[model samples]
Target chain A: MISTFIRHELKAFWRSKNTGKSIAVRIVMIFLILYLFGCILLAGIGMDKILEIAFPNDDLVKSFCGIVLIYFLFDLFMRLQLQELPTLRVQPYLHLPIKRNTLVGYLAITAVFSMFNLWPFLLFLPFIFKIIAPDSGIIVALAFVVAIIGISVFNNYLALYLKRKSNLNGWIFLITAAVLILIVIADFWWHFYSLHNISYAFFGRLLTMPILAIIPALLGIVMYYFNFLYLKQNLYLETLTARKVKIYKSNTDIPFLSRFGTIGDLAANEIKLVFRNKRSRSSLIIGLFFMFYGLIFYTNKSLGQGWYLFAGMYMTGAFVVNYGQFMFGWQASHFDGILVSKINFSDFVKAKYLLFTTVSAISFVLTIPYVYFGWHVLLVHFVMCVWNIGVTTTIVLFFANRNFKRIDLSKSGTMNWEGVGASQLLLTLPLILTPYIIYTPFAVFKHPDIGLALLAVTGFIAILTRNYWIKQLEADYYSKRYRIAEGFRNK
Target chain B: MIEIKNLKKIYGNVTVVDIPHLSIAKGESVGLVGNNGAGKTTLFRMILDLILPESGEITSNGEIVAGHEHWKAYTASYLDEGFLIEYLTPEEYLYFIGGLHQQSRAQVDETLTALGDFFNGEILNRGKYIRDLSKGNQCKVGVASCLLQNPQLLMLDEPFANIDPSTQFRLKNMLKDANKSKGVTTIVSSHDLNHITDVCDRILLMEKGVIIKDIATSSSTLSELEDYFGVGQTVGATPVVKIDEEENH
Candidate 1:
């Protein structure tokens, strides 16, 4: 029965509707996976040398053991962002005559085949075989390898369980991310404790007392059994899936927006859309994370200060770029209704412009504390704000029409590459390059102030011609409305 | 109120919708009965100006519908789930549609109060988005949205398919009352001949992208449509042979 279940999974991968149609995308993904595998292999082979460079005085094996817990902690964090649960694969088998245990066991075991489970072996196995085995007995070496695998499995299942719980209740995800952030802050900024010594003390014993490896193995088994029971009980179709959100009552009225009449109504709808969907809402949350990104660059002050422009642009315009790039797609679920509704196309486009301008302005106000770095940083940010509102916003909205991939609103955005398309990947070129084109000439002449002036001037032009750009975009959209509608309908 | 002249929409070589010429009167309740893929939806899409036709035009009230905004003022259509926003609550969606038709929120609330029985208390203020609602409840929302707009021309596709039996009866009576009082020209396509026959005054039976039977509904319209549909075959329903049997009647 397990074999049949695995076979069904294999067939599902091969016959997925989206694959085999985009050969170029398939080739690109394969190369990306291969590149990741190559990096892991090189890291595995060079582990001892890396340890020697980082900690020259300590024993290589000791240093490695010291970092095992740290490695597992980082692994859990990465898995939280990258891993996906194959929870729905069991839906097809639920009605069959097979025992429920068989299906649950199949999902738990098959989940271990993830690249997260394998990348560690490619990273640490070489050091274990070369350094640990020759010095200690082979049994001790085997115990070390067993301990590493055990911890990897434990992290894998634990992350999956937390993520599963988070899917059921969104607050769980927020709380888990908050706790992880707090831990990092406490350990790094407070310097009140050291995770390094704690890990060394725990794993350092496994080398001398091979029997101590049983602890990690026991942890792995406990986590696996916990996941098994959870999956067994919740494998029912309705339970594994998310239901309607009924937790908090939110006001449906936006008094300020309602005053704008139809465009205001559309903007209010767009706001509700961003807050309601898992994928789009995650983008909103992630955009907030970038508001703090300037600290990484502003404090350094050594990267030639050109980076401040890029960072400032991102800090103020990330949401505009991220959300506006998928502008029409956010409404792809109901493009048919929009096409037939009484609302004018230009009014819809005007609503989008208003949304982008409003978000960019709000993000700028929220980042005012960044001016403490230098008034220069604030000046660059102000210019970029105008540029984003005037130029980048239009560029992303134009690309939105070319994107045909319909995003399923219920699915989370992290590691789920559902709505990504070639248009989005290509959109960044104009956004990044145009400002440089306007900026580089004056900077070459030792008067970089001239470059900022030119960019601002061009942005001023764009801002002044907002109505014209909107009309042009509206005309372009009118020509392709049917095709866009068809693309969305097929999905 | 609606006219389709020399309309032709072909998918590759297959003629999906090929109506030579047809006109629906201003107050006519027309039922479009056909097998699956017999161009019922394709025709409705053209009438709504959602899809472009290849060789002809659809004019809503003498104005060419394609690329025109004037027709939408009085035309409200709910062809499928595609017509719904799906992310808003039922009340929110109704107000949005009402806003499009320039109806005040208070007026919309009054209209929704009238539809409270048809909604069956599962839609409005249910704290669920339309996408999360059950198929039956979603249908109630979609149909109720059409009624709230006070549109002169309203279109609904398969209004009886997913609705509960009790709601279906309520819907039939509501549609009948709305048409009788407002004289709204409605275009509805349905597979259930009984419900549509009870509601629509004129029935157009299409087969292989052609209107094979156009008859005013009477006592025997359901039996005639059933004979055309045959038993146990919905998609493969062939109505060409029923023309001769109909002529004999």
Candidate 2:
């Protein structure tokens, strides 16, 4: 039965509509995994030498034992971010004669095959064989290997359980994150307790008493049973596969947006789209993270002044570049309704412009405190903000028409390349280089202020002539609406 | 009033919708009945200007729908789940559609009150987004939003397929009211012969991308459609006993 299930999964992957894209993504992921495992292999082989250099006073084996807990803790955090839940199409088999335990067991067992489970071995096996074998003979080394396997299994199941619980009730994720953060602060800053001592207290004994390793193996079995029982009880379609109704307070309206009438309504609907969907919300969060781009360039004085423009452009325009790259694709789900509704194409284009302008303006405001780096940084951000609103916004919207791939907004944005196309890759080049094209000539002749003025003035001009750009975009959209709608409907 | 002129949509050599000339007059309630792949949806899409026709064009009130936006002001359609903004709650989606037509919140609330019977208390004020709603409830939300527009021309494709029997009865009354009193031109495609015959004044029977029959609805319309679909033969024919006997053995 398990073999049959695996064959079905393989066929599903190969027969899926986006198999080519998924294969490309898999190839890239294989290379990345190879690189990461190679680094871990090297680290494991030289663990003794590295630990000896770092801690000259302590014994190398003891130091390695102390950091095992730390490594697993960090591993848990990474797994929470990166590990995907193993999902099978259990709906088709639910009414069959097969028992429910078999399906749940299949899911739980296949989940253990994740890279998170393997990384522990690549990081610990060589060290275990080289250091523990000669010191305590073969039995203790084998015990250490068993302990590593037990701990890896425990962490793997624990992460999957937490992730599933968090999907049903999101507060689990928040509470877990808060607890992890508190732990880090307590250990690193407050000196409340030492994870190192606790780790060694357990693992240090395993050096002499090989039988002590059975504790983690037992704990791993307990965690596995916990997962199995949880899955067995919640195996119904409603609890397992169906999206639960989120109990959100019904307050999506923006009172101020009502004043703009139809255009405002369109923009307000888009704002709701961003906040209410997983993919768009994560992209917004990522854009907010890029506001810290100036910190890297400004603190490093060796990088020179030219890099500041690039940083400022990215800082203020990240949301525009990130969100606007898939402008129409975001609305692809409802493009049919949008086309047949009372919305004008020009107003549709303007609503997008309105959204980009508002977000870019807010981003610029957030970066104002960076002026402490020097007034020049603020000047650069201001010019870039203008350029982003006037020029970058239009460029992003123009490329949006070329992106025909539909994006499923319910999916997570991290590592999801659903709507990515060649246009997205090419979009950044013009967004970064357009201002440079106008400014480089003046800066080359030792008149940097003239370059800044030119960029700002060009942006101001574009802002003044936005209606012309709107007309151009409307024409472009009319010519491509059929193809765009056709692509969206295929999904 | 909608007119199709030599409209043709082909997918890889299989013509999905091919019409030489067809026109729906103002204030006409038309029913389109076809099996799957008979081009009912493809025709509706072309009329909405979502799909471009290969040979000709669709005109709404003398304006070519392909490049014109005028028809959208009075035309409201709900073809499938794609027409719905699934993230929004039912109330939010209705209000958003209302706001598009410049309907005030109070006016929209009034309309919602009028639709209370059709909604059957399952749609409005539900805390769930449309995506989380069951397919039947989603159908109610889609149809109710279309009615909220008070449109001069309304189009719905397979609206009866996923709704409850009670709501289907209520929907038939609503369609009658829209056509009889308000004179709203409605185009609905359905697989339910009884419901389509009850709701529409004119029925167009299509097969393999061509309309095989167009007739005014009357007493014999239901049986005629049943005969065309071969469902009427089962009424007079002898029951097949071999399968039941074999199963018993």
Candidate 3:
């Protein structure tokens, strides 16, 4: 029965339009990663004779393993992040002859075969095989893959069980933050202080001796069973019940925004949409985490103080362009009524642009302490603000047309990979590259300030061209409304 | 007023709805009755302009239904929970929908004033999100939202399906009051024959994507209506109504 259920589930998954595309993307990504890692491994092995460059030692391998562990945890958590099964649609099956345990077990096991699990092992197997074996290379590589896959599966089930046991927002946030902090600290300790070196050396000795390879494989089995137990214990549907959803008071009472006339109401709605929708709200929080990435790049660099400003601007300004691109389309599922309503699409775009500006401005304000490194940081922040609002907004609006996937707002706060398509990939290239593209000519001419000025000008144009772009959007919307409607229904 | 001409909706090769020249007058209380897959909901969606018909045009108030700004101002619907933003607490959604219709918070409060008995006040002051509410309570919130908007054209598909008996009674009366007193045009589609029989001024009997019987409530007896439904005929002095079974066009 369990096997049959699993077969049925896999068949359903394979038949799904979104799932099939996602699987194809994952396969391509794995191939690319394996190719890149293969180059690194070959370089390590071949360089021994050419340059006598010391091969990465057990310490580096152990460091790599620790970082990989952190990556695996994030991946696993992401897979089970929201842990919302498409159970409602399958509710009728509950009354069928199929047992609950069989259905639940199938789901728990299928969770192990996630896109996150396969790529890491595929990427790392060749490198580990090079380090460990020559004659029995396949066996050693198999052992490493088994162990990592087991660890990832364990984390996957553990995250799912946690989500099943408690759907409390505050608790989930606290636990995720705690896990992230611990992983970061452990990674730093292992890398700089060499805490894991001796342990890996011992493991390496055992591996050469042929006994430790057996141990990892055995440990992998144990972790797998441990995760299986966790899932089995928490499979009850009622266990996943969340606390009542909370309604927040509208913040339209704020001055300035309230005084901005009709634009104010649209701005307030945009903020409410972000707050009221789980997916948008989650991105906002994740954006906050990304803002600190600049701190690491800037503080650790001995490069001139000017570089700090640039790095900081890039980090903080990243969120606006990245997330703001989805804009009005995120509300596309039920957007027909909104479109037909008295509200203007121009106002919708303006409100979104304003929201991006507000968020980026807030991020800039928070980065002032980091500017203690130099006042050039403020210049970077100013430039980033302009680039995000002006240049990034135009690009985002252009690409927003390509993204038609209707995100399920209910499941958005968790690690949902829904609505990601080839279009999103196309959207990312220009977002990441356009600033450099626009700034390069000025850089080549040895007038870096001119590049910044151009970025500012581009942003200013986007802000001013709001209606022009909205008109273009209006024309595009009429033409593609049927297709967009089709995409939403298919998902 | 809404007009649907040659409205055909096909899911792949299956034609779910294939109506020709159906016009609903303003301020008319109409009930749509059909079995599952009878295309009642599909026709309602076309009139509401939620889904476009493949080979038809729909117009509301002399304007193309597709382009009318504030079409939603005159039209409010709750076919299912899809129209409700589940993440919001009932109060928030209620207020939000009300604001969309340019209604004040006080107006919404006045509209919801009678819901205290129906909901036991748990929905409003209880700090609970609408998604967390029970199925019955959620339906109540859906009904309350539509009522708060006070739209001219109200489309409800199976509103009583998940609602409690008490709320159902309140809804029946409220709908009747809206039609009679406020002149609000309502189009209610339900599988429950009694709901349409008891409330609608004009009940439309739909079968296989076409209206088979368009009988005024006052002109038909309950048994004759049942016979028209093809359940069975009854022997009585009640007049028999003609049901057009061959309107292929």
RMSD (CA, Å), each prediction:
5.3, 2.6, 7.1
- Expressed as tens digits, the lDDT of each residue in B1-249 for candidate 3 is 877788788888888888788778898999988788888988876776667777888887777776455576677777766566565668766766776667777988888886777776657867666667887888888778777777788888888888777778878998999999999999998767777778798888788788877878874545556676655545455867777778643
lDDT tens digits, residues A1-491, model 3?
76666577778766654342665566655677688667655654553232222334434444444444545556655655544543333344566887656755565566665545555665556556665456446665565666665565566556655555445454664677577667657756656443344445544444445445455556556655665565456544444344322445332343556555556656765676677667788888887787776667666767643454356555666667556655445675556445434455566666766777777788878777766766766776777777776667667766766667777765554434567666776676777777777777777778878877777787788778777877887677666666665566555
lDDT of 1 by residue, A207-278 (tens): 789998888899999999999999988887665654522663333977878888899899989899999888
Off by over 4 Å in 3: A20-234, A240-266, A272-278, A289-316, A327-329, A336-342, A369-377, A412-417, A430-438, B3-20, B54-56, B219-221, B231-249
Candidate 3: which docking quality band? acceptable
**In model 1, how large is the Cα lDDT of residue B216?**
97
Greater DockQ among 1 and 3 belongs to 1
Stretches of candidate 2 exceeding 4 Å from the true structure: A17-57, A125-142, A167-171, A242-245, B231-240, B243-249
Q: Measured with DockQ on alpha carbons, how good is candidate 2?
A: 0.75
Candidates 1 onward: DockQ, in order: 0.53, 0.75, 0.24
Please state the error at residue A38 of candidate 2 in Å. 5.6
lDDT, each prediction: 0.84, 0.87, 0.66
Clashes of each: 0, 0, 1
Alpha-carbon DockQ of candidate 1: 0.53
Ranking by DockQ: 2, 1, 3
